[model samples]
Target: MGMSAGYELSRRGLKTLLIDAFDPPHPNGSHHGEPRLIRHAYSGGPAYVKLALRADELWRELEEATGEKLLERAGVLNIADPDVYSYAGRFQDAADHGVRIEDLDADQIRFRWPDVRIPDHYRAMFEPNAGYLYSEKCVAAYKKLALHSGASLLPNTFVKRIQAERSFVSVFTNTEHFIANHVILSAGAWFKTLEPFVRLPIRSVRKVVGWFEPSVSSFEAGTFPGFTFASSLGSYYGFPDIAGAGVKIGRHETGEEWQPGEDLVPFGAYSEDEGDLRKALEAYMPDAAGKLLKSAVCKYEHTPDDHFIIDTHPEHSNVILAGGFSGHGFKFASVVGEILANQIELGHWGRDVGLFSAARFSPISP
Candidate 1:
């Protein structure tokens, strides 16, 4: 969100200054993990579908402008047992948003992809336009574009304090202090550090993502698509073997509670996560069950409702806060960036961001 917002704000002739604690395209934040899923049939609601559509357009635009392949349109498959969870809402959202999709039953899924072992009670929704985004490449592209558009990106600069006044905001870093007419706090898990200035009900959880070598060529990129499955165990999502990276998988609903500034568990430290993933593969995708090659820990900053908080500071309108992405917010980063830039320049973004307002939370006395 910071990179995209900085690019858009600077393109609109605003003196945008982007500050980050670590150099971007680094593995410290949630934007790591090689690839992130991007789909149009948003389970969040129809509002997200709209944003994702716009984001899809902007991603293509960015790709054309930068000549970088950021989005891979292999496809996305959402499968779940009828008794576990119904994906009817996903299909409905796709229809409402004019996104092309195909509803398939377990037999059809099994016939279409022989490697997948779907039970007879399961159903699936396939969105041909849905795929994965090269997350790191997207950030690098956005940062490059932002710099080209006259934005100053200060990396490895830790922000110690942010004082938002009625007119301008003063940001104090470890080394120096800078002032700006407007400020955007897109800090992921670190948003909690702003305490009295900006308060939101957000929790950061540690998540583990694993990559396993596919036993067959059917799980490769050209043949297989990105997929999500919900069952009695939990919800699992994964990608095909892209660039020989292996089939990356992660359990969406289970993770350990994490906080910023704490030591992160080293990659491959948790064998439990690997075991869980292997069990999931044994049930749904037997062919994908292979050697667990690598795994890494990431953070998810979630709100109570799992919706995003893209609104202004309760006390200061010059300050914008964009956090609480939960686990499924990266797909809309492009549109969210535009919205943040719009909020800073126009005092209000044109989109229907009422669902993401900080005002939805009870006022915290500053």
Candidate 2:
């Protein structure tokens, strides 16, 4: 997020510095191989549709500027029971904003995509504009463009302390200290470490993902589109094969939580968490769950309500904080970068962020 924000600032001709604890595309952070879904008709809420729209535009702009295809239009299928997960908000928002979505029933789904076998009780909302972000490629492009736009990026340098004053912010590192007119905390998991900011109610949860290599080649890239299944137990999402990683699948919700500084290495190093996920896959998506190639774990910064927190610091107006993406924040990274830049330069973003305000979690100041 910091790298993308720095690219935006540099494009606007602002002096910006990007700092990260590890390399830009390193797996030490959350922005990784986990495929981020970009859906305009969001089930989380409709307010995000506006931001999703702006994010699409910014993603295209970045792709054009960097000459890299960051957003892939493979389309997304949001599957659920019509009565349970009604598409009232998502459908209305998409219509208001001119986003396209295709409604599909079980028979219609089987007809369109025979490889998928959804039950008659299930329904799907398909967004033609949705697809994968090719995260690593996008990060590389953003870093390249940020450097070309005169932004200084210091990788492998960890931020030690942040001293906020009336006018500017003093950022301290292990080796040196620097002052900036504004500061934005786009750190993924270390967000709660900032003491001056409000103590956000966030949980850093450990999530495991698996990529299954189907014995047959039917579920490969050209044959399947990304889909999310909502079953009686819980929800799970998967992606089609694109990078030879096979059918990547993960549970929408995780089981355990951890602190930011905790070593994120796998518990047993080589042990696979497949036993738990396999039960889900076998019940929800049996065909695609047949063969398992590999499995790994990642971290998710979850808020109390699982929505994002994209607002400025309460005490210091010059400092902005973007965190608590939960597990659904990466798809909107392009617009998030733009919003952070806009907030730092103009003091406010035009979009309605009432749903994501830090004030929602505020306690009574008695």
Candidate 3:
């Protein structure tokens, strides 16, 4: 979110600086995984249909601007047993938003993607336009553009303190303190440790994703679409094999509570890191449920409700807070960045952000 916002802020000739505790595209936050799913026609918590569509536009624009293969047009499939809340919500959402979804029965799904071995009662919604963004490359593309647009970046500079005053914001880093006319604190899990801002409603948790070796070539990209499956067991999301990288899958919910400043326990540190994803695969996607190849651990800063926090600071209007993305935020990075930039530069966002307001939680002290 910070990187995309930085690109927008800087691209428009605003004096901008992007500060990162670790060099960006680095494996610290949620953006580390190779591919982050970018599907629409929503449901789960809030309505993100329009926001997601606009993000699709911006992603295409970024692809044109950078000439980098950022997003894959492999499409996305949402499958679950009949009458599932979240899965059914996607159908209603698609209908309401005029988003077209190709309905598929379990037999069709199995036929289309031979590696899937779902039950006969399962159903699916296929969004041909939906797929994923090469997350690290997206960040790297934004970084290059932001720098070319004359933005200063302070990589490896950990921000120790931030004071959002009535007029301007003062940011204290490990080396020096700098005051700015405005600030966008797009800190992820690290938002919890920012002293004065700690009172805000966001909790950090650790999550893991893994690449599993599949038994067959039928699971390769183009042959299969990115998919999210929900069952009585749990929810899981995955990508088809790309260039022999294997099927990358992750759990949608549940992770150990994590404190921001501590060193992240590595991916394979826990048995469940691989076991959890393996469980989901064994049940619904048995064909691609081969041996685990590799894994990665990521952090999510979630609000009480899993919706995002993209509103202004309750205390300082000049300070924009963009965290609490929960789990499903990477896809919105492009639009969220623009929204943050608009909130600062234009003083108003064209779209309604009522759902992302922090006021939903109990008030925090100034």
Point to the candidate with the largest lDDT: 1
Local distance difference test values of all predictions, in order? 0.88, 0.78, 0.86
Per residue, candidate 3 scores C-alpha lDDT tens digits across 267-301 of 87888888889988888778788988888889888
Candidate 3 has an lDDT of 0.86
Task: Encode model 2's per-residue lDDT on 66-105: one tens digit a residue.
Answer: 7877787888877786655666567777887889998888
Q: TM-scores, in order shown?
A: 0.98, 0.93, 0.96
Candidate 1's residue-wise lDDT over 1-366, tens digit each? 999999999999999899999999788889998799999988778888899999999999999989999999989999988898987877778887799999998899999999998778899989999999999999999999999999998999988898877889999998899999999899997777777677778899888888888889989998899999999979999999887878899989887788778888875567767888888988988878888887888888988889999888888888888999998988899999999988878777979998898888886436
Candidate 2: pairs in clash: none
RMSD of each: 1.2, 2.4, 1.6
Q: What is candidate 3's TM-score against the reference? A: 0.96
Error of 1 at 298 (Å): 0.9
Clashes of 3: 0
